[model samples]
Target chain A: MSATADAAGPGAVRFALEGRITAGTAAPIWKSATDTLVSHPNRPIVVDASKLEYVDDVGIALLFDLTRRERPPEAKVEIRDLAPNLATLIGAYDPKKFVPPAPERAHVGIIEQIGRATERQIEYAQQMLGFLGNCFKAMGLALTRRGVLRWGEVLDVATEAGANAVPIVLLIGFLMGVIIAFEIGLVAQQFGAVIFVVNGVGVAMLRELGPLMTAIVFAGRTGAAFAAQIGTQKVNEEVNAIHTFGLDPVHFLVLPRLVAATLVLPVLAVFADVIGLFGGALVMVGFDIGFVQFYYQLLGAVSMTDFLLGLAKAATFGFALAAIGCQRGLATGAGATSVGLSATSAVVTGIVVIVVIDGIFTVLTS
Target chain B: MTEPSSGTTQMSAVSVRGLRMGYGSRVLLDDASFDVARGEIMVILGGSGCGKSSLMKHMIGLYQPMAGDILIDGESIVQARGEAKAALQRKMGVMYQSGALFGSLNVLENVRFPLDQFTDLSLEQKNLTARMLLEQVEMAYAEGLMPGELSGGMLKRAGIARAMALGADILMLDEPSAGLDPITAANLDRTILSLRENLGFTFVVVTHELQSIFNIADRAIMLDPVSRSIIARGKPSELRDHATDARVRQFFNRQPDAALEQAA
Candidate 1:
């Protein structure tokens, strides 16, 4: 079997004897021959007939049995590189010839072959399109199917992506507002226009910075959580089980988190804006801008449109997180290594998509 | 579709005809045909890569057949949809080899899943039904524990509990005893028998476990590993008596003494 396994790599075994052959030579040769054919059935094998080996009728019968009327063991086997004259006695040297088999439809022509390849390419394109189509269908199902609200999962994502993230968003928002207000207040005072500091901080936070900064924070936080959660499920074959149960995994799993994040993010961005504006108000008031007047100017500069725009951007960022997280997780196969790879890909892809989408919205809204 | 005539001779739970399945040039099942009767536990036994799971998948309508018809209660599963598929699912319960309980859900939730999804049962009703099932499978204490917290035997029992949640008339258990200890395996078989006795549901169990086969199967079908064909199907005693095939005999020799006693 080992010898056969080694030699069988290229073909099925075959031999021919022209003179008196005994079992002594035949047995070992038969072993090697059957062993070779047994090991690698798919690869083509050829027995050289020009060596003029003679054999008895029994050895000849064994040879015939080995090559001519042999049952190919369970795998596809074909004999190739046969000499024409010996091929007659060897009975065409085609293993499939003896095995009654279904005939395949023949290729039409050269042009038709190319057309077939082109058709295959078209088929692949259709497959990819169908996969994407299914994704959209899943999105639609997500909207319609009311998932059993997993409060635990919600709190888990919240604790990990939201609560743990508050310190950073707050710190950044407060510092940025204070720095801008202080710098702008000094510059404004030189020109006796210190009132403008409130306008500067309010405009920046509400129009652009608040949403962008918070999304970037969450791009690190909840984005990673989504990847880890879904990736682990994929690794454990939990996703496959969902499909076996006739449930759309995306609708049951991804949609709730997506809805939660999308809803929560804009609210977080608004909170960031409020804190940032207040921080700026504190610095501006120290620079002789009256508290009431600073509040008035801040309100005037930051309109409902500004908050709405930031909310819109935050929503876009949310979509990016969900898409990247779900895509990477679904792409994962069953292993811890695959899950790790998926997590990294999720983060990278989420950040890229978020930035790209943010820029697109900024340009369009501008 | 053959309608079940008032409890005399049970109609076939699953009937497959001219079943031809292939992936690329590799044909797995070629013109395979078989019928499994109601209340008769049937096992599709085969070695690794012989398409036992694939055939089961087709039977369950997970993978569409390449070329053939699968009749579950006389309606082609391939042609089944909407209410038809839903009807089929409601009629049949499946337990995968891995005991695929949803990890996020605890044992109770896992068992309650089919009821919550398919039944109009209220939350309290679902919970009560789920608890009843867990108790039936002897996993009532494990109800609050997640799938990860359960042992292999416990997981299999939990899976079985979930399978029975909908009170499916036909249960399809794939490798239900694959990874369990001998005691656990025997317990699982006992549970299966109890389900049959109590609920009178038909079962189609796919497994290589001879112990399970003799313990639970009313009729066994041998899927030849080499030929990739159904070489024999009959009562285990008849298979032992009439089965001249070397592989079939080899399978019988390996059956546990408990299975043989159960068969007797």
Candidate 2:
């Protein structure tokens, strides 16, 4: 098929369309044809289709482009010697469709970007406050025996977030202990104070690394899972479904996870502490300290205040991770991608909160 | 309309044979068969929880059926694998219920995506073509907008534009007018008719909107979840008036009828 412009006759510029005109065929000549057609603005379109065999939507679109662009309303466009079938086919598409259109969008400057980020953070804080209030209300109901805990779900979450996480937690704790003991003992050896490394490692592990390392690992694993689960449920309207059943989503969904995490974290931290001490002792043997000497040094260096404080921090960190994960999930906006973003945000925010809480604890103790 | 099929796949654009569709142990469509003729708009009609959408998914090779063959043009999509399945898929375009456009791309980029994948056209040419298509669907004004920013009607229009970009002969639309206002729904029906009448596109639409069915369907088949098979098939008018099944009659009458129990 070919589209050629000819000034043979007066009324309007004439173009003869021959053979087939489809998306496949029209694509090769479309640029040249439309470019040639637009050059004659004042003249109307005259389509000579005496040899035309077929035309599809794209071909029809070509004719519309001719009539709609440049030509005045008073100008006349005509089709001559067209077969009845092709005539009927072209009649279905109206030429007025492409009168004019363009896409418009505003630009966001750097200042606005910063402002928007700040606004988002403020909104997040406000939402978390409300979530915290709802959590306390649910806890009050449970304590008063007005609301029953779904223990089965609590145990299931505990198994997933607690028992499944043991290996990784122990591994991190052991590595931290070994690295700290090795670094401190190497520096203290030149001063004939290698035994001080035992005291240093002992106090740090019990008071800081055990709870912090376990909580960080849990934040990445369980926090993201909680967010994804709740976010997906929110996206699928399952949260709304719970509301329709006259049950509080926070009480039914968030509380079980919160309870499970808080219950299991201290137990996991105890495992971390014992294994960490073992790892430190293994490294301490190279410093000429016997196992009994290392154990006694650790006992002298650590206090009941430090042990109980670490347990409290572990439980608090667990509560924060579960709460942030569920909050991020319940904050889901729309669509599947939104659920993914919620999960990512949950992990990131959980870690940040853990560090902030740790800093506050250090200040209060000092 | 390909002379109105007499239960044969010989002249059909899309043919489903011995199809069994369900989830796990629960069956929704069992040994179901239907034929959609060339260049005709066929509506898959059924009540909620029926297998209308599942049947469409099977045709597109998204869901594998228990036992069936979905023939697109002349190829069996159920058995076609790798490039063979993709080749058969290129002949058809599907618009999902939610207008599931790629989340990251803008409207124009979404429409141009198939062209970029399938054609060697220059970037400028592809953009112009995509714009023309968006104009055809009355969506040129929102070409820069993201899928998340669009309203329901706009999303459907942008979806139609993207579907048409590939020039697939068979277009399958699921609930095109579900959340639309009456005027917008009617406009969508008009767009469907324009495409079929002008471009000779064959359509398999899954919708229960009474107005939409009468507006565009050349033929329709009704699925009964209870029977787990198609209970009625014919031109929309004929099925509405002459179908002997009370359940079919209950649907067409649009009111509670003494002869039938509600499908849901």
CA RMSD of all predictions: 23.5, 5.0
In angstroms, the error of model 2 at A223 is 2.3
Give one digit per residue, the lDDT tens place, for model 1 in B1-264.
011123456568789898887577677877789898876678888666788888888898888887989888787888888888877766677888778888777888899887677655445445655665676677877877877677878888898888877656678888889989998899889878866654456788889887788888888877764675788888877776678775676577776446645655
Model 2 segments beyond 4 Å from truth?
A1-28, A34-107, A133-145, A148-153, A182-196, A238-253, A283-291, B1-11, B21-30, B106-109, B119-157, B179-181, B254-258, B261-264
True contacts kept of 1: 0.00
DockQ of each: 0.02, 0.21
True lDDT of residue B17, candidate 2: 93
A336, model 2: CA deviation in Å?
2.4
What TM-score should be assigned to candidate 1?
0.45
lDDT of 2 by residue, A1-366 (tens): 887778846757777877776566666656655665667666676778776666654555555444445557645567777655445644644545434444345789999999999999999999999998998787777767844778899999999999999999999999988999999889999899999898888778887888999999999999999999999999778999999999889988999999999989988888888888889999999989989999888888888998889899999999999999999999987777788899999999999999999999889986
Cα lDDT tens digits for candidate 1, A141-185: 656765545556666666666667778888877777788789888
| TM-score for each model | 0.45, 0.82
Interface RMSD of the candidates, in order: 30.9, 6.2
